[model samples]
Target chain A: MNKRVGKQTIETPSKPRIIATASIVGPKEGEGPLKDYFDIILEDDLNGKDTYEKAESSMMYTAVNEVIKKANFKEENIDYLLAGDLLNQLTSACFAAKDMDIPFIGLFGACSTMTESLAMGSLMIDGGYANHVIAATSSHFSSAERQFRFPLEYGSQRPPTAQWTVTGSGAMLLGREGNFPYISYVTMGKVKDYGVNDVNNMGEAMAPAAVDTIAQHLRDTGRTPDYYDIIATGDLGKVGKRITKELLLEHGFELKDNYIDCGDEIFEHERQKTNSGGSGCGCSAVVDCGYIYKNMLNGKFKRVLLVSTGALLSSTSCFQGLNIPGIAHAVAVEI
Target chain B: MNKRVGKQTIETPSKPRIIATASIVGPKEGEGPLKDYFDIILEDDLNGKDTYEKAESSMMYTAVNEVIKKANFKEENIDYLLAGDLLNQLTSACFAAKDMDIPFIGLFGACSTMTESLAMGSLMIDGGYANHVIAATSSHFSSAERQFRFPLEYGSQRPPTAQWTVTGSGAMLLGREGNFPYISYVTMGKVKDYGVNDVNNMGEAMAPAAVDTIAQHLRDTGRTPDYYDIIATGDLGKVGKRITKELLLEHGFELKDNYIDCGDEIFEHERQKTNSGGSGCGCSAVVDCGYIYKNMLNGKFKRVLLVSTGALLSSTSCFQGLNIPGIAHAVAVEI
Candidate 1:
């Protein structure tokens, strides 16, 4: 019954199913290609909230509640709620959880939080620690902009390498029994830094970590790239996606057309005026929970590998002239 | 085999042992009551680092290395490194993990991180996800002061209700086998907000959460206050500790002299001029890793409950007029 595989990947023989999923997005994301897949779309980014932080929390709360409702389960049915966000101190996730009565564990993996929570939730179900668990995360463009870079009011000019932060939230409920796509393996990532210090270039900072985890997962499971219908990375936008493909090829893994980056898929780059692509915890979260999950149910994808990447940097760390450290966690789902 | 008890408590029947522990503290903490119990005490808080943030990361790195050394295990032997801190984006943990090759999972429970990490680590071992895992956390007074409150150079006067942020790091290694105290159960806490808005009074903000988790653990396990040799609340200080006692009493649980707060135990209140007491992620972490773990091995205590409380607030949230939300996670250790 030992679930650990090789060095870092964990095999979930019990195959905890993704019983329910919900995604909520702002107006901009609602106009994206995956618009029809989302559960809720806000007319305004603030959603009548006073601040962007509160809006982010509201989005996450809606996603969590919607997911539970979708599963036909009350709040009390959930044994544990594992959540995180990009905000400092995880304000969004914590505030969202405050309204719920479930036991909570807050996580911080930057953008990788989507997979981090999913992996932990799966482990809880596979390990017999709980029957139902909710894994969730959120990110808001205005909130992240003010915290990490320039405020939206400042109207700072973005470089070509800069990516748009998605204003959205995603929640997935994992249960002991379901006929949906189930989590079969999880590859925990290591902190990987390649001395990338440009705050504007998150893609470059996070690419190596994505490649590292993806390669590790394939190696640990002894599976070829063809084993998965699609290999998706969390938020490594255009620049990082290209780097990830090259680096993965160097690792003897050919990431062909089957490979995609959530950041790259989240928005219409040119039409949306997103320089690189959509980037944030929400980018991958909404993509996976909406498009990916729905497609799997429709028999489009039999197997999928989700590698959520995160750049572990803060304004303080950047001010201190430290390089950004990146991390990526992978969760394998199969029908 | 379900392991989950009544509502929130998850029993670890496999009993993952605390095989190794190490604590490193700043000069101020080295002068405290449990100074002799720590593995390493620094003469300077900065430890030759340019910034206090780096100092915190270095201390945590030292603690992780020391614990691994104490356990006679190589870096590869440890399956996972679960760590967090009070810093934004968990910079200290990420930088520390950057040096080590272990798979990392970043967590953010504010000060409750120690027990949060411990709970997750215990679950990992109990669930057969990994053979070994490390739970660690750190905080630095200078770094936290500037980030959460005023800059140290501001020489801002602290009120009696304000607790001192501890400058230290603590790491513990949990494994499948050992002749030491093992984690028996973990009671996950819910985010509880009581409309306490004072930024300086963390104890008052976190007290209700501490009480809730403690009472829930007792109710779920069908245990009385006397079931534990000592019940410790992490960094609740004097004000919060008193509130916790009163609240628990209202819940029909009378915590007698067996109750202790890590915040109160760390520093000599009057002598150290730490108005309320030491309060930070390091407060409970260093105490448990240095004093409690060592004492347990020496048969000085039989069963202990470590409840680490956290006030989830940031400068942004506080500025936005949001109330501080508190959370507490408990891990029961028995010899």
Candidate 2:
């Protein structure tokens, strides 16, 4: 039975295993530092699709198929597909689910969707509700830019605080038991808003949420930062990562050298000209499913904590001058 | 233990109970047939908020607070808040969560979100991950119109098949044990597309998915349609409800007089001047939480199957000339 550990954390005694994983990225992300980690790197962002939205859906579909294939499981073997993406009404996930033919549970947590799906999937497995489930998410640079920011054709100059949206998709298959790394605990997060209104500075907006969830996770699990080999925050970039470190310090928890941000690690920031670094639903997804999963299997990391952060704002909300509220969900995985 | 009954259904033996429910509606909905069943009815749709989006968020916030209050539980006593709405990036749900201070899991199934949240919340309670959870959803006609269709200011011509978006909010509090109606089973849905491209005719688009889930649920649980006192679909409006009846007949499961559509029951069609009927996330939400919950408590309904249907389409996808896909999640409740 799954145990409610503390205020926010749930301890999954059954330890749902990550049976298989796959990641696919666009041309720009392929040129980044984690290039060798991804399973497939597209030559172009559009991938022969007429629209960027279709391209995003195609990438997610490919990743789902790849993960199932890696697990040697037929499509019917999967019990559920929990997926979300940074799209209006989750268009990409819905389109991908249409092709997959699995029982679908649609989610929307902005960029935090990866860990959100992971936490829910783990709960379903640990509770004996399902034997196999897939968690997946995707985001496209061009599609996000047009929806959230200026259109690419306008050549709008972005501020230094702006982060580049990652064009990629990642899929992870979880099972009741396996030799692979297992999900041990999950920490659900509350929305945290520090009244940050700048749309370009999502890092600043989401940092408080990252700090809240991470600190709450540590407190609930009764573990220090040193307990894990690595504590990774999803897509906080340089600016948000620094803010998280400072805020977490104020919360009486000091994140040391073991801490990392997927946004900061995914790209060669200065060389790649990714101003603040990579950010999107795809940022943490690709990094965790590709680089982190591979390293965990290789025995390079025994235990890891992944906190995927999301800035809950829309173009409409931003235009209405509403404050951007941030949220983060943390999942602990161990080998 | 939760048992996977068949392909899509899960038998929740623990039977998570609906401890309390609250429904709030706008002026138009307040004038509807089920108006007296709602907890609160606003004189105006805006509810004094400047923007329609904020008004929608405010309604959801009120519904959450009202539900908790009705249950005699404090905000902190609620373990999780699962919510979604019809907006870009789920603006209403995020903003509502920001004010609630509870662990939030954002979901997006378009109008089907009410049942989706309920299914997830019930699973959480039955799975031992949470003791008490709130499942909620909201939709405002003006906000949805501006987001999905033309703005109200445009005075766009509507087809006879077009359904009027409902302006309301509903919230249900689910606990591990209680004397109230309990969720006995849940059937997760898959995306179903019949190549329906007409944006105005959403009812026809979603009927196939509704029929698919209802039939699958009955087959998985080894029950006939007569097992439920009432089997309700979320927002199939007039057009979709007829289509659903015909399709289910073809599937060898005849939906008799016990079948109802929340959208169809919401308003007095021709008198209300609602083209097809009322529709939105709030349509099924208010009907179920208000009319259905109250009736169940009064021994009017011993069993109910709510299959919330959603058209998984965005304005972007519609503009791209893509076909609209549909999904429906069914939660069986019994006293």
Candidate 3:
């Protein structure tokens, strides 16, 4: 059976199961609406570490370990660890991976790392590359701010379009044979540049890519929006969420009943003062692992489309006046 | 049929073929001994670009396009493009990927990205995920120096142990069916930290990882060093090459013959003034794609073990006094 469908999608002949998942967040995200769903909520963003980078690494280490523990497996049992973070050279992920004995592959999809890891893990399992793989990602608000934008000590005022970088980590353990939410299909995305260069407006930059991937997935799978109980985009905030909806509608598909943006829902915009909403790799990661996965297990949703969007640009590129390019990968999960 | 042999290795049931490969390098690399093997050699390191980052991106874009053309496939025929670079957030790779319409998966294995991409690309093809995939990576001396160490304007004298980052790019097109070098097996790597904190001596930091992966590959495949015509490590340079050989000897495996390090062979040490020799993601990449792959086609080597080593550490981690973690992945290529 040819697993590939249409152009950029792959339908797994043997669905890859998400055996277990874990999420860790800082006090800010813990105060969010989905606080009860997170496994570990830190009292401080630094988590007692000397630096924010070290703290982020510690969080990721905990998330990876927690996910493996929840799967009832030891460190040695995991065949591979696919992970990444927003920091330069994926500092958090590489540092966290150093503590584990699992063979590791480092990925970088910015915020889309959550679904990128999930999609790659699923493909690896279904392709017989591994029986079990751990997909994880982490992000720290302080670290990201210093690296991507302004320094924490600078006390810069963010634009209304700016999204808060979530300080958290998420991990999912995937297996070939398991009774869990099965990854059925994957739609890989092409880099799309909509001529948006403002780093502060990542949501606007990434929204088109989210819509592009969702539409491609739908077309490839021959399914309508109704086929999925929930349609989720990773970190596209309120502005990007609305833009995605409008783009979908323009394509003759309306996401009327089931639509969610992880960034938009992670926090209360007015109360939390997170500008547009939560962002970063951990934004969508914790939402999917802590909230969505839990609800799927509870039978609240039987089918879901996860479109994890990423704005792929560096500070150097932005400084060099290059347009921000966005990419989004979609994964179809069924219970 | 199980494909997986032993703990950390995967033996492809249907060996994926390297249908086509391309390499582009700067003037210094072109002046090297293996210059004859490279496809395109730029007259200058800048390659007429405003910045070294853009130059690196252009080199990668050209390499990818050339490989696809050599493979007799159009841009749309490519199923996926797996690429990365040493820059923060993989700017060169992501920027280069913007020109292509193929679905892109950005990876980061540092210098090991060359073999890591090949391993994943091979698995995707053998696992029936895609008929064709392209693995590519790039690195520029000026760009990597500015990002990882001092600015080019700093003009600080390099230590004797330091290696010159290669200014080059390499791309390989893998297909399910093709008359090319067959990818027979892959040995994934575990992150190994030896408490080496000196970011300048990446060779020493990454040597142990190369030895570890090579030992695991031998153990997993149940093969002796004699099985392979060439056992190569990517960008480990003279220091790392010696350390790797010494470590392998301590592990009861003697690479008595047919052992090579891509970094050691890429440049003429004395003439090039590259103290410890060439090092970077592109060092191994261009060597593998241009020199080794071409020689293999000409029957100079039958079976080879290509192990690409990486010292996974960010400048922030180094500044914060963290030990460098090393990783190396191996792929078996046969005629």
TM-score of chain A of each: 0.99, 0.99, 0.99
Q: DockQ (Cα-based) per candidate?
A: 0.88, 0.81, 0.78
Model 3 misses residue A104 by how many Å?
0.3
Residue pairs with clashing backbones, model 2: none
Poorest 10 consecutive residues by lDDT, candidate 2 chain A: A1-10
The DockQ ranking, best first, is 1, 2, 3
Error of 2 at A63 (Å): 0.4
| Candidate 3 per-residue lDDT over residues B220-257, each given as its tens digit | 99999989999989988899889998999998999876
- Compare candidates 2 and 3 on DockQ and give the better one: 2
Instruction: Give candidate 1's iRMS in Å, 1 decimal.
Output: 0.8
Query: Of models 1 and 3, which has the larger DockQ?
Result: 1
Residue A322 in model 2: lDDT:
92
Candidate 2 error regions (>4 Å): none
Q: Residues B33-124, candidate 2: write the lDDT tens digits.
A: 99889999999899999999999999999999999999999999999999999898999999999987799999999999999999999999
What is residue A296's positional error in candidate 3, in angstroms?
0.4
**Model number with the top DockQ:** 1
Off by over 4 Å in 1: none
- Reference A-B contact fraction recovered by candidate 3: 0.73
Q: What shift in Å separates residue B67 of candidate 1 from its native position after superposition?
A: 0.2
True contacts kept of each: 0.87, 0.89, 0.73
RMSD of 2: 0.8
